[model samples]
Target chain A: MKAATTSETAEREARRNRIRLMQGNEACAEGALAAGCRFFAGYPITPSSEIGEYLALHLPRVGGNFIQMEDEIASMAAIIGASLAGVKSMTATSGPGFSLKQENLGFACIAEIPCVVVNVMRGGPSTGLPTGPSQGDFMQARWGTHGDHPIVVLAPYSVREVFTETIRAFNLSESFRTPVILLMDEVLAHMREKVILPEPAECPAVDRLRPTGPPEAYLPYASDRDVSPLAPFGSGYRFHVTGLYHDETGFPTGSPAKIRQQMERLMGKMERGAGQIQRFELTGAVSGGSDPVDTLVVAYGSTARAAKHAVGEARQSKRSVALFRPVTLWPFPEAAIRQVSGSVRRVVVPEMSLGQLAGEVQKCIPPKAELRRVNRVDGIPIAPEEILDAIVA
Target chain B: MANRIEVRFSGSGGQGIILSGVILAEAAAIYDNKNAVQSQSYGPEARGGASKAEVIISDGDIDYPKATNIDILLALTQVACDKYTPDLKEGGVLIVDSQEVLAIPEGNFRAYSIPIFRLAQEKVGKRIVANIIALGALVGLTGVVSRKALEEAVLSRVPRGTEDLNLTALRAGFEEAERLQRAEA
Candidate 1:
């Protein structure tokens, strides 16, 4: 009887971790919930509507709030407001909506508000392809907001990574006190795959650092520390918030020294913590093997999946090729790229855009290395065969 | 079973083609202890536009999610059959709805033209469950996933009160597939 009971308990425990057939958008919502996101505000858009729809039905059940704002700008503003009120907040949108959120996104940056933004990329300059996939926003995510600001953008390749990357987006946002963008392409947003998610206990949630000093003595934008603690609005601690360049006291300042200090501290936080924020994966280059790969394939998002298949095919044909995929797209993983590309003379980058990511990779590799690009802008994904041809050619 | 099989279900948008692919992927990944990835391409129309959903099931990891060399092609309309027949591998399995896809294209593959929609309407008393019926025949024809797992996935996805109706439609397709198998033998 005792043995049977123990076996039954084990079976139930295993069942609790059952594999789920999850879509990428669905996994993002689950990740937000796991990261303790208690507020979501967004306008529904193509390739990203499911994330909003899922949260609309499930957020209230978990005692979280979900609001459908009138427009993308308001959606971004609402999340900023929620974050100021001591809640972990997020907003999800696609290409066009991402464009509309740029103004508020910059506001969040200048204000140093902690929030999450999910950009499910699709073909675009204006509302190009609603259901199609594209990575055209690769550079836009970094520089779209107009000024010099520190931002973190994470691009997940598969459904499993979508879950983990979304959680990491929240964690990095809170840790840096800056808005983080979870970049996902159309294919990654809509594709479904089997994922056994990590349990809550396994992936501990992270909250923003709180001010320990007296409420009256708090400085919202203190430059002395690497990251100044942010106290929620309406709390005992009162502080001013604005879009202008501010001093350590959280009020606007015209003094050049104060402006320089604030800007330096804002950019320095990321510079010192780049090691903890940047993530990349390297494969096909054996550590101890003598055959150094002469070709390096750089990719991210869904395109990386095709690149991975092509890399495996090349290896089977006795070709020396390696793959470098960046899980964190921003603060660009330059150090890892330089280290891996030192031995290779050829670097191939395949993306849905003409050459967004290729442009960035060009600045990092050896000056003598040849950069080859395989681009697809016809609203169709780059196939594995195309990548294989690039690898061998 | 082969190391990997790529299956594509092509039909009109409202015909539940994507949902059929989703159920098959869930059955294989959740119950059979395999890796499965499902993806789709659809136009902006909510209904009537040509839509295709593809599933890749493998014993190992699935790198590329889209189906290139299709092992199984299930077309519910003539337009879909004409469009996707060229993607099928030689000696691949092609299943189409006989009533809807009247002019079947020539292909280097095994073809099974079943009265899928008609059977759902006549035997199951509902035309909306044709996707479920088609799923049963596809599984019965290939044995790609276990029947128990298929039933479980179907029940979990369908509406609460419609389990009995959907099961009856599924069993009808299975019976028809069995008859075809016996005739070939």
Candidate 2:
């Protein structure tokens, strides 16, 4: 992949391969741009607003389009429109805004529109803490929207991972022809750190499967080939797209047979890409040994940082502890979590939310293992000391 | 984590203390090639509200990005000085504005009384650049980031046409802190 040396892309290329200390929100915007996204529509919300600010300032320079819609609903609708027009599009919002976008989120999923929606999570059941961090949206990202349709939610731990994970989000969204939620908490969104960004040549980019035939031969919702090829609207592919359960031809069909097939297809696309989407980092308890550690720690996002540090601290005191970090939240890597579960006598799951991820981990915990929870809901992140205390206790 | 140094800047919002924290983290992470994380507490109001920013610089990865045991605290106002003093580690350095601060709390930490705001207003001709002056003084006392790297970080973030005044403020800060250290020695 060569730089788009044209005047439009010169500004974008100038930013690549630089060592800049950047906030996670800013890096995510740059990452989206690098992944070939050319359209953005977002509403301003604290913590995640920097992403909109950065994109609004720089998107025009790179020949991209940006619109601040009236609210999150319109913002989500606008990105789906842009994506259906054959342009890569995205939107960023915090919890309240994310809640507003839920209906449209389901629309994009059933319609097979390739778009990215970024939810920088804050403490919330309802605008709970606008400027503080929380992982309370863990289940919301998966089950918030109305249907049984599949979702791809990717979480990042650091400034650099936010960049790379965003690129992966876009690629997976386009590759799977679905809406991918790039989940971030307030801590990851607002915290600034150094990142060694990849050169534009190395950053991966993927385009949606396009139709190879004339408009007459196109099937907008066909899933015979895994992810159906999405023909750009107005590109002569006159296909119906709707929120209702649809048939293979992209037209709504209420018949039970067609509905079953369409629903299965929506679920099957992610199932096919599960291996590619699932990622986990596993470390032994004793640092240098492959011995079956008696205890294991499981975490994700910002809490993973605390869990990791606590694992190291626990090991320093000769308390055997291992760490399992799932970078992908949805399609929860149950297999990996279960692999380490049967052997460890105890498993600890610490989360900023009361017990969302911990509840999910309970399903995979080995029956013999005693499940421990180090839960916090005070709008502050779980510190290493808290997790370490749980480990030693 | 022992190799990490944690620093915090606290003052009212208009004092630009948050930007100083950003610059210090940038100087270490980018120019000095160390890992750093900068974060802040955003108050409801933009000015006169309590504003605090923290940066954790380390030679390796930093987990738990917020400050656990603050190594250095720069308090530009009495409210900040009083509120943040408890979080300071044992023997940590606490620098406060001598003119604005009337009392110094007795603690295990080393306390320094520097007229940073006065130095900016009187020497640099703008009290708004006091954060930069404090930044210069902090680096001089701690030797955390090199003088040149801090200067580059400060100049890059400061607005155009005012770079000279900010540079003057930073230098004045270095000289004043060095004088205090020499006198104490």
Candidate 3:
């Protein structure tokens, strides 16, 4: 993928500032467009197929390129190649397709290339329920690629939230210089809602930091700076990128001291930027100076919506329930969760999967507050009534 | 305020069950300034399948977006009505095509049997717009959404040059609904 140097020119042609009824997948595509994504390569899969379809139809009109790759692995490779060419790129897929892209996802993580991978989660050990909703990929999203590489994952609950979060995903990927995962479940990917999209000019987007130094002086993996600024391939800066543990010069090396330095810096970028990437919403008593919340519900994606509604309904019935919605799923916002969970007696983690997120929440909160989990794997999105019942009972 | 209403549109595929649900949701959300979400049965949500599309409209943010306990059901087929009727809330409204669905199930929810598709074919000159006709009758019977909002919403989404036919079907649907309401009373 040759770098299209027309992202600025393309924005002039994009549909700007309009309120329209949009599905969640369409919102994600629109968000990618707003974030100046200029390249898309993906194979179609249920639920997530709409994202690729929407982009295929509209990307060219905005002067971006959308290719239907031979398979999911090629789709993943193509996006990384485009990103290296200095263009923002993305791919969308469901669980099985996502599983196929894992090797390249590991490649992108080890190489520290900026890109976005949208996984619209579905039931699966393997093609379990093609069109149904599932958060079963929560662990796979973070650890599926194999290795201890840092990643940023954002989950949006509403159509509007998905739009903004997609843009945030691209911005985070660019700023952090890592591939960011916009983790969506089948429910959010297929549901349609009214979204008032902001004008293109109003969207805040970040381009990857580039090296301003002379080509000979460039160190692609240098840890002296907070982030190693990347220069586009064929842009007069000659550099080598390898998945192997490389020193600052982007070449392969096997020295223990050098490998440790590179890994720590790779990991430390997320550790230092966790505050910027961590986004969560605290609702109910946590929002006011009322009595301390006895139960704090920690949730994400579609489950969080049900949790929020349950908290609202419970508050009406004189229950001390609060909601902690993690807009950012990975680089798990443990500090914020811990803080809001301070006054609460217990933290309830509800998810479509069987205790994926709950296991992580359990590790963060003190033992003084019990950690409770409400899990379902029947491929049905968790109903709010179930959360409400859990809250009251 | 609990201005939340759940509406389900069920029929065979290609009848625009999903589109009609979206139109109803857009009318409430875009034109009437409400929070609305529409979702459909995922696996076989295509034409000729047992398809049902649902919309939840609320004055506030919606939680539990699916129509677990439907307040209104527009069943264009007997199969749709039979498969979906049990989930209707007590005192909810069930609107069915009287011509297509001969035996209506007895339930606590009020039932309105109107020949929605036949009326669309006879009055509007096209049976394909039956979903729009059913939508019109739905607005007329339940008043869940304003007729003006629904009209604008339909016009915005429907194919170009067919607005007048859809509009006619909508009006005829409203008339049939009014006639049924008077007869039932």
User: Each candidate: what lDDT?
Assistant: 0.92, 0.88, 0.88
Tell me the tens digit of each residue's lDDT in model 2 across A1-393. 354457547765555337788899998999999998899999999879999999999899999988998999999999999999999999999999999999999999889899999999988888888878889999999988986988999999999999999999999999999899999998888889888787777876989888988788888877576787898888888888888887888777889988887788789888878999987788665323576778889998888988998998888888788999999998889887877776778889999888899898989977888888998877778999988888888
| Fnat by candidate, in order | 0.95, 0.80, 0.73
Give the best candidate by DockQ: 1
Winner by TM-score? 1
Alpha-carbon error at A255 in model 2, in Å? 1.3
lDDT-sorted candidate list, best first: 1, 3, 2
DockQ of each: 0.94, 0.79, 0.67
B1-185 in candidate 3: lDDT tens per residue? 27778999998888888899999999998888788999887344565777778999998768778888889999989999998999999999999998989989988989988888788788977889899889989999999999999999999999999989888988987898888788878
Residues forming the 10-long window of minimal summed lDDT in candidate 2 chain A: A283-292
In model 1, how large is the Cα lDDT of residue A161?
89
The count of residue-pair clashes in candidate 2 stands at 0
TM-score of chain A of each: 0.97, 0.94, 0.94
Rate residue A332 of model 2 by lDDT.
88
